[model samples]
Target: MAKVLMKGNEAIGEAAIRAGCLNYFAYPITPQSEVAEYLAKRMPEVNGVFLQGESEVAVGYMIFGAAACGERVMTTSSSPGISLMSEAISYISGARCPAVFVNIMRGGPGLGGILPSQGDYLQATKGGGHGDYKMLVMAPDGVQEAVEMTMLAFPLAEKYRNPVMILGDGLIGQMMEPVEFPNNLNKEPTNKDHWATNGMDTRKSKEKNIVKSLFLDPKVLNDHNLTLKSQYEKMKKQEIRFEAYNTDSDYQILIVSYGTMSRVCKTVIDNLKIQGIEVGMIRPKTLFPFPEKAVYDAACKKSCKKVVSIEMNMGQMLEDIERCVKGKKEVSWYGKCGGDVPTPEEIINHIKLLLK
Candidate 1:
């Protein structure tokens, strides 16, 4: 396959189309608005549906409706936009409808800035909305990985009959890089006759398919929640993904990071290695089913004395890192949330300080 140079957001839109997802309903937001812009033009050429909803809230429901009808659907938004869509996301999860959401995170507590930040890590992994719900969250470090994750998200969502999220910082959306859409990822939408409300006549089933999230009876609701819990547990057993860097060596410090932050840590590790300071890193690909065992084992290495959680947020992933380390090694955090990414030099300085 010939690689093409493209913006991360544009690559994501093209990836989705290649995956056979024709229905895209979204509202434009910074750093990710290019996805909407690109798809708006390309969708028509492919005879796909590209509708810009009045708001993210409306877009969320549009996805839910399409998914309930067993159509491949997706939406993209930034931090505040995703917040408005959280309620519908919850409903989609409870109803067991397969859908995809892309969050190109911007700085925030509330509409902070248009710059890149990993502030939405907690919201994506932990529940953004009310209730015991989780999305299969994937974080991409670069444009090419972003394309692959967006294509993979569709099948994963359908496999589990739940929403899947592509969590990228604004940098991942704005940066241009060479990317190739894998031909293997081009696939037909899965069969949804078991639950989709497409139509009895369409599926040739006598029973009517009704999609819903409202469970009035207490025991029934409890059972539904338990079912969701089982799926999440299954994910933990089968879907945890991560990348280890320089762990083969006897490293003095282990760094746990993801997305764009991990890229910086990689550079830091290489520069430190040149100076006789061995620093290792673990980059998580899946956020919800976090690579807990990877972190735990790396931290337990005898050569590793300190562990640090580096992110673009105010240590949102720190709690999870500490949990995985389990007091075996000292765990700390270093980060910036004002849209300024920590430079490799800054990280090396921090590591040196920790060692001293």
Candidate 2:
């Protein structure tokens, strides 16, 4: 309704409520506890439900229940909590329940740290849970995108009848920014009623609707996978979103990164420009859809020599980088792990080393 200065984590929680999500379930985790705190107080005032479950395990099951009942439900947690929730997130996907999830990632192989990191990029994009499922992962670089994408996530999840993820770093979650709500949330695509468990009586009398991922027979499983693959093709065509910075230059190096790291890379590019070193970046906004073509295009360019994929993890995104580039151009990676963010100066140094 009105623009406000908000922290990314708290704003994401508030934006979800404003976007008509009344049910939330979560177990608090550091760097994102503000999300839980904001909603615990706000949900009751809006006549909504905010339950602090026993653990992330319980909270995830709570999400499964509410979403199954046709409620717009969501949950927020950091990496380890999300890891605990993955079992339920898998079940939620099997039921084909459209829901929203926010992973304000902290670095970790396990209990690594509480600071900002992009280590979970692959986990978010690829199948993190059991079975063949895809979550529409939206990587937000700043607090504004965090707020806006949190609101956008629900409709997008509803549109595809799939889970949607708001993948942000702890820094992005803690930073402050100005944000505005969409003019009308209902302006989104109309797909909520078809698969949702709204009513049974309104449908055809003889037909029954079942949402599940189980297909025991080999042929049946093959067919089901085909159907999912078709849906992924549509996403590749229609929903591949990315941002390019300084990409038009005759750059010798293209920096491949996303989320807050990509925002930092933007500044690195500016500094490189001052030093007469042309560099560019391809920031994948939808990590699943991946903007693979964009990655290929950049590396295929004659002016671009190599791509340096920067991430908080050692080399999580570099796998995708290898996939896209496929030897068209060289791809190298540099990073800091366990909740350490790479500074612009450090990134520039990495770029210089790559050049050398």
Candidate 3:
């Protein structure tokens, strides 16, 4: 239970091990390669399995295989790597397999850059893969948070019988911070017996539990889709998390951000307040079931004049921000892409422009 200074990627691996995820398969990519490297060494010490697969595409199926056997499994990748794994992610979702994926995103639409960027926001929340399936996405702001969320992912995935993602930008994956892994993170992972494809010899019944995404019958597929939809609605109600900073008082501008960008916005809000500029911030901790109602309430404050979303991409999260505010207020976006980041002063200047 001692706190140690560690990079984000390494911490994620350690947390997963502590959370009883003994199988990890991933391909190394910038900003998150440390996760695999760390696991490669540590997994053996704990009697776990760690494999650097041929590629992200291969790793995705490796994860699916372990998960279908009812074992806790995970994989990590950067944006481009995640793109390759999307097809398998979709299949895993359709099969209702419990697997964890960590995306330490870099700049991308293609192989953009190795530096930090929030360019994968849309891909993480809006489904990078095809079909009507949705993964529970958790966005963390710092290395310590990254550790905690990584541990939480396994339980959530098992609870819903679905895939879960820990979404962080490159900054979070590469930065160093002090973190402590919780001792009570379900070290003895949940049982997945009822639906798991354990061998016939291990099950009570001789009938096999087939794990496949194929549904040829229209009626059966519709029922399956409806079940998925119902779970999503339950997640929205039970899992929405956001941090409200300086939102209790009147403010001139409301800033919405997540992950590393929200950390920078916090500094801007503090500095702006010193100069008699009042600003409040809403930092969403969950991106999928976004804190829409929280955002709408903050944006509708009597003294709130403008809304802005500052990101490290060409404003992917702005789409959700706009949806939350509706047409009552126009949502403005300020962004830098291709691994370019915004400074606190730059964000303060944007706030000034919004005020004018």
* Top-scoring candidate (lDDT): 1
Model 2 agreement with the true structure over 167-270: per-residue lDDT tens digits: 99899889888887665675333454455555677543344556666778999888876776776677778889899899899999998888889988999999
Show the lowest summed lDDT stretch of 10 residues, model 2: 187-196
Q: Which stretches of candidate 3 lie over 4 Å from their true place?
A: 204-208
Which pairs of residues collide in candidate 2?
A: none
Model 1, range 29-53, lDDT digits (tens) per residue?
8989999999999999999999999
Q: Rate the local accuracy (lDDT) of all candidates.
A: 0.94, 0.85, 0.90
In model 3, residue pairs whose N, Cα or C atoms come closer than 3 Å (at least 3 residues apart or on different chains), thus clashing, are: none
Give the candidate number with the greatest TM-score.
Answer: 1
Over the stretch 164-213, how does candidate 3's per-residue lDDT look in tens digits? 99999998999999998778666654757655898888887667889999
How many clashes in each candidate? 0, 0, 0
